[model samples]
Target: MTTYAKIIVNGSPITKSNFKLHNINGRAILPSNSGKYHDRYALYEQEIALIARNQNPDIVLEESLIAILKVYYKSEKRHPDTINITKSIFDGIEKSGLIINDAQITRIIVEEYYDKQNPRFELELFGESEYEINYSINKKSIIDNPKLYFPIKKNILKRDSDKNIDKNINSNKNTVTNKNICAICNNEIKTKDYMTADGGKTLICKKCFNKLF
Candidate 1:
């Protein structure tokens, strides 16, 4: 008997015959060509890689959920928006016998999008207590789903506080350095030099300072 691990994407079961796996340096790698929705599946592969590299077990299942979401999005092409995408991903993972808590999954999605510098999709995972997750293309259906929205007002506040703390720390670091040399320009800092608000500080040589200032 040959033993093979079953791969499930977005609530759909994928078999070894339909997918190809390669081992690179002891890591399991799934080729982008193994699935019809190669683009989305590739994202899944990347997510899995990130989870493994980070050693985050909490998000391992969520990564799988994302894989399924990509597959579903490729097929449905509409409805439920990002929230629904998350819900459907969770549902599919649950049905696949993966053990994961709903709240945990929600937290992961919230952080992933929140931390992304340039997100491809805009999803306000934190909002009203209730909203719809429409799986249909109809705008009316999306407007009607009550459970689509997850209340994340508190999470947003926390993120703000975290940002403020980081800003303060960076500001203090710059103040202590007191080097006004423009990081972009190769200049030296003198005792009487002044640094600007930006990382570049004015390290005006007495001549340049007298000329410019």
Candidate 2:
């Protein structure tokens, strides 16, 4: 299904070169004005920010997506890298709360051509179920070696076998020390992807978090 948050920004087409970081006493950030390109990116951010503001993002994806970006150009000049353009587009989408994170996207498709009149971009999202790795299956692939994706679903042990379980758990509590792992499944985060819950410090992966809230 072709479903996505309807977003549109009207302005000169932006490019990756238009984005550059500036340092203000050791804090790095997007520069306000460094060149025409930088100025254009600044404008792009503003336009996107306005487009994303105040809209309730209701769609969540447990799998990856097909992001088809059709970029229309005013001239035949070589454009910046498509990857950079994709970044510029979705970073704003994530910040605006359209979805949990952009890394949830598995495939990116870019189509470039001239549009002397009405130069702009068209972005559409599609489910990536046909291509993305299945979360539960990938995680628990080893059937012989059992591991827990979440808390035990049932108490399978008899009372006698459960005697030392609490002690063993408390003894190795700190063995796996990355606190930012997914609270639900305890998996190491895949990328600089993933989002925080609405009003909590807990982190959740897209597959797990999308099922909640």
Candidate 3:
């Protein structure tokens, strides 16, 4: 089952069914909100700031409940309320460990309003792709012998050999041939029988080849 995390902003909890936590350096932050994830501007800005400050991020997995609050009163128009909410959210993000420099804010507007039943909000922050988490297991305790839990050294070596062979075959296939011409220099190639140095069709002349090499 996918893990979730609880998001807390300005001492208030944000409810969400599936929570994914990201740790920027040592700081922990949330990616998605629970229920109808409406506050896009606030979340995106905060994420950007975090990415700017921290180069390496450590991810945390957990389950969380989020309560989304409306910025404006029910009777009031949404425009003013949205502005206020965005401002407040930005303020909260600034104080929530993410440091924003003098960079200009880039905003993306979502036309459709967020609905709990029919929500249409989908905005992902730009950063490095997520990686899988690997757990270190103790093999000696789990099995009668530690060797039984892991593949034999010979088997591992054989697999590596097979992989290397495949790689060599692929590299040979991709190597440039003598018949191909160089895209940069329109020179006739001397070697047409053998494979070119680049594994592409040989097109570069001796002078061009010397310059490139």
Query: Which candidate tops lDDT?
Result: 2
lDDT of 3 by residue, 91-208 (tens): 4334333323112123223222433333212222221133222345475745563323344356433344221122223465685332334333543344532223212222234444
Consecutive 10-residue window with the lowest summed lDDT within model 3:
119-128
**Model 2 Cα lDDT, one tens digit per residue, 109-210:** 778767777777766666765543322325455557543445537866545422111222345554423335655566766664565432333444666544
Output the lDDT of residue 173, model 1.
52
TM-score of each: 0.20, 0.48, 0.20
Least accurate 10 contiguous residues by lDDT in model 2: 161-170
Off by over 4 Å in 3: 1-80, 102-104, 110-124, 127-213
C-alpha lDDT of residue 59 in model 2: 55
Tens-digit lDDT track for model 1 on 39-74? 244444344334333432332332212121222222
After superposition, the stretches of candidate 1 with alpha carbons farther than 4 Å from their true spots are 1-31, 34-39, 52-80, 87-117, 120-213
| Overall lDDT per candidate, in order of appearance | 0.31, 0.55, 0.31
Positional deviation of residue 85's Cα in model 2 after best superposition, in angstroms: 1.5
The C-alpha stretches of model 2 lying farther than 4 A from their native spots are: 1-3, 17-19, 22-27, 33-37, 52-63, 129-213
lDDT of 2: 0.55
Per-prediction count of colliding residue pairs? Answer: 6, 0, 25
